[model samples]
Target: MSASDIRAEARRVLGICDACGYCNGFCDLFEAARRRSALTDADLAHLANLCHACRNCFQACQYAPPHVFAVNVPRTLARMRHQSYLDHVWPQTFAPLLNHPVATVIGVTLGAILLLFALVLAFAPAGGGLAIETGATAGAFYRVLPWTLMVGLGVLPLGWSALAIGLGWRRYWGLTRPRRATTGEARRRWCAWRTTLADILNLRNLRGGGVGCNDLDARFSPWRRWLHQTLLGGLGLSFAATLAATFYHHGLGLQAPYPLLSPPVLLGTLGGIALMIASLGLGWLEWRTAPEPIASESRRLDQAFLGLLLAVAGSGLALLLWRATPAMASLLVVHLGTVLAFFMLLPYSKFVHAGYRAIALRCESLDPVSID
Candidate 1:
């Protein structure tokens, strides 16, 4: 759909929703909408990102579907949210990949893995990089993949993803008037910042105000919130593990393949398990629940992202478990390749949602009524 069409539909839904305050306490989207007289571009973008697609409002709405109002807030806001991703994505030229992202992600990831595998095979050391056991040691991994190439693979893709995400976030923030223009404005924005940050960290709206979200059916449950927390916590821990490893390697001059009792190994092992479980759980939850309003395209994008996360976690664990065997060499390549793929796709995938949502929350916090 075109941008203008999305904006029009969003405005129509917002107008109807504004008149009926039944869903005012369901989520941040509704609460923010309640404070607005009409929907502007900024208002729509903020409201769209605030939505978590829990489908609570749809289940609770009296004027839903069969009625004339036909107010499907979740579905409407989801499409608008997708549009925002496309609009704010950096490089602008690659934004079309958001249309059906699974193909692009799969193709790019496989190609990178294959290319890395070929390079490893072609440039093996005199004893050979593959088909030989490196044994368990501090610098065993480098015997398979050179430390320079491995580090380059790790750093370059992450740097690119960070830059792209930063650019996209800046653009989105501009749409929402992200900065304070005056002294009072600065204080108000600061207040909003605190409110928004607290709400995001706790995922306050995921609880459907007080009750839980309408996750599986009309009945409310906190399973979705719990699962989301698991996912975020796992991801955060995994990132911390990487940082710890980086510090060990650079600051302390430690080498590869730390022992199981070490901080990096323990953190990564637990994180991998968490990520794997959360990815699987989220996929199951999406399958079991009713996503009537969430578009097929958006669901596909979500699946693609979950697929990448699973690949990263699965391969990481596999490598860790069998690092001393001949299989370690190939496993290292697969693991690093998947990591590279994850970073390269980060800006265009569901990962971008975090940045967009953070900006939206910042905008919402600026409203005086949004406090607490």
Candidate 2:
């Protein structure tokens, strides 16, 4: 019915969460934290970045809690993603990125170019003037074509994300209070930017990671956790590499034809593949083994989000298959469309959790600090 009702239902009924480390073994965030010395608020925040939103924990935690809680970890995480819009985080840094509109816009635009830069380089020689023309040498096309992409596809979305952060940071939209907004909206609006950002990014409040603060208790399958983390970590690495390669090749004038097979290139390629595979794999697991069905009100949106992902991955695979330079550009065009649609619609879509979970966790971090 109302939002609070939904949250209550989630923590009490729908969420099959147990405070088990079963999911820990499989979770990448957890793995990264473990690999390091002590898990900090920064560490928890990083964990949020890598979560796959797969409900494998739901299936695995069946017997841990006596009653199923209604809390949706994924959804909450999505809400916390608002923190990212407020401040642009690279997801892995876990540390705070002082909110910067220029950096946000530039970083994302560069990322888009970087993603397809390699293909562009491969086509550059074909275009003759280091600019990829339609039917030029693969080198010409590879180097030049990405500019068309960077110009035609990349700039708009990056510009928007930067705009949202810039505008939203100033409280333009946030100031327009909801008529009958609930406490949640109030908290979201009035919450101190830094504190809330920390909480949302850190995800210290989440009960699942282990703690008696919240009722959520569940054991998750290690296999699913690993799959989710591997994909997330890999993708984050891929994104970073994309930026590095672009700077090296474009800015420094080095010969780095990308989007082809090599060590790191192969790894980036593998990361994208892992994302698709993991998405499908976890989707299958959810269909086969969810603890309970989501409310009908939420089901359609949920399915739509899932369907979009399937399309993103499917389109990507199609591009890889048709990598015959000419087709690669078109395939890239399709990717830009889907991904842009995906990011722009984040707030309204089920994907919002991708942003929010860590902030909640960060709030959790403050409690212990106060207790001591």
Candidate 3:
């Protein structure tokens, strides 16, 4: 559907919901909706992001599917959430990538891999074959891909993605946040930040009014919430591992290929395993989930982003396992390529939902009437 159509549909569904008020206790989205007699485009955007797609309302909704009203809150909000990503993505030139996620992700990843291969072949020392065996020594990774070149390759794209994400977040906030300051706006915002952070860390809304999300059918399940927590935990550990590696390199003069028991290696290994498991599980859940609660158009985007996560984690683990072999150079290139592709696609992918949702949660928290 076109952008206008989506907004119009969202307005219609939310208007029905606001009038019904039956699902008000299900989530903050409803509470926020209660405060608005008529939802504006900005209000719809905020409500869309605030929805966690828990499917509780869809299952409980009296006017759902066979009824005349045919209210499907989860699916409607899912589509709107996806649209919000497209609408707010920075550097509008890349916005189209979000539409064809599978193609964009696969094409970008392959391009990065090929580019890395070309760079390796061109920069390798004279008389060396395509494969350079750099043993299991410290700093061996640098032999295949120089430290400076590798850092540059990783940093440039990452920096650009960060800037893009920050700008996109700013745009979303500008649209959703209150235009005028209240008497105690600063204090209210501070409280909202803390509340939103707690909600994010715990995947609070996924609880679906205490039972859990309706993942597969009408039955409430905690699997989705657990998988999300695992994914976030794995990402945290992986980031921590990176930080530790940096400290070891710059602070202690230690280098790459730390021992299995070392902080970086141990933490990265665990994180990689957790990421692989969570990504695979979440992908499976998405595939097996009932069609009613899902936005069919969003499957490709969700799967594409999950595939990238799996690729990065799996490749990193493989590189660690084979660092001593002649395959290390190729594996390093693959791992780095996947990492580069992930960073480049992140701002334009389903990842943006996290930032947008956080903002929505904060906005909900700042509402004058408590949702508790």
Candidate 4:
């Protein structure tokens, strides 16, 4: 599309942004402005940067008073995304799936099924016995516990990786099928990648710093971006801890009930708790004070996803506090299941915003002037 079209679309989106903000206070971007008594073009730029296009704000706005502005931030930020691409800072590599609606749904569905199967088998007792004969030491009830885990967790994840790799290869560089994307679609796909990076990773378009009540506390000091940095730190630490534990136990022959102070268990618990709080608190603010009548329009999918996340955190905490075996295992499984659901249902959920935001940022870098 030409710059004129992009501008018209953007203005239309801005109108939606304003309307939603007016009714719902969902537009934290403008909320920040309202708090500071200043909403300038510069603030808009800052807001743009902070916007990962998660659509939570927009979704909340849709549920707001004036439904006129269904400003799909993803499309609204396309112009900036167009610019990010030329800068070679795209977050995700995109292809036909960027535009292929059916592909996204199917891919996510298959992924979920693959994982669920693993979970079922892992949980289920073996065909003939509760205790499958293992070549391990005597008194080791090792037969069922870890073996089930290996087949269910380890094997299934492997299958998922294989499926993704094979499908990606066949779809992109495969021998059987070659993609045929029109030039216009191709450009948009590239734009998607750009926006995904800038909007999601960098969160370049959050609308504002924070409302008055939140601003003073949200210090943008050299230490960090409140939600962003805390989140990243937590995720990084948690993932590392998970990997370490998985390797030591699953790979090198260690066991569960690793000391609570163990690296992986402790770190993962800490990280998980921190992320749980950050995600829940910030996300709650997004929904709760989400600008009145607008907030009511929250979608089931978004609510369910975030709620699932909250539940996972709660379950983890419960495990620690109560330390009930059945409850702990069940909650852990639920946490795993929800996380699996997230990845499996990825393309179909708002979480897709993460990848798309990065892509959008790259697109913006490619052509800012071209947008208008």
- Which prediction has the highest lDDT against the true structure? 3
Give the Cα error of residue 53 in candidate 1, in Å.
1.8
> Whole-model lDDT, candidate 3?
0.86
User: Against the true structure, what is each candidate's TM-score?
Assistant: 0.94, 0.51, 0.95, 0.51
lDDT of 1 by residue, 32-150 (tens): 77776557777788788888877888898888887898888888889999989998999899898888789978987898899778878876565647765764677777777778887
Residue-by-residue lDDT tens digits, candidate 3, 1-372: 888888888888888987898988877778787776567778888889989999999999999999998898888888888888888999988889999999998999999999998888877655332466655778777777777888899899999999999999999998888655556578777887799899998888999888999988999999999998899989999999999999999999998978889999999999999999899999999999999878876778889999999999999999888888988888988999999999899898888888998888887777634222
**Rank order (by lDDT, best first):** 3, 1, 4, 2
Worst 10 residues of 4 by lDDT: 170-179
Best by TM-score: 3
The models' CA-based lDDT, in order, is 0.82, 0.44, 0.86, 0.44
> On residues 5-44, what C-alpha lDDT tens digit does candidate 2 reach at each position?
4334333322233233455643333333343333332333
Residue 20 C-alpha lDDT in model 3: 90
RMSD of each: 2.4, 12.5, 2.2, 11.4
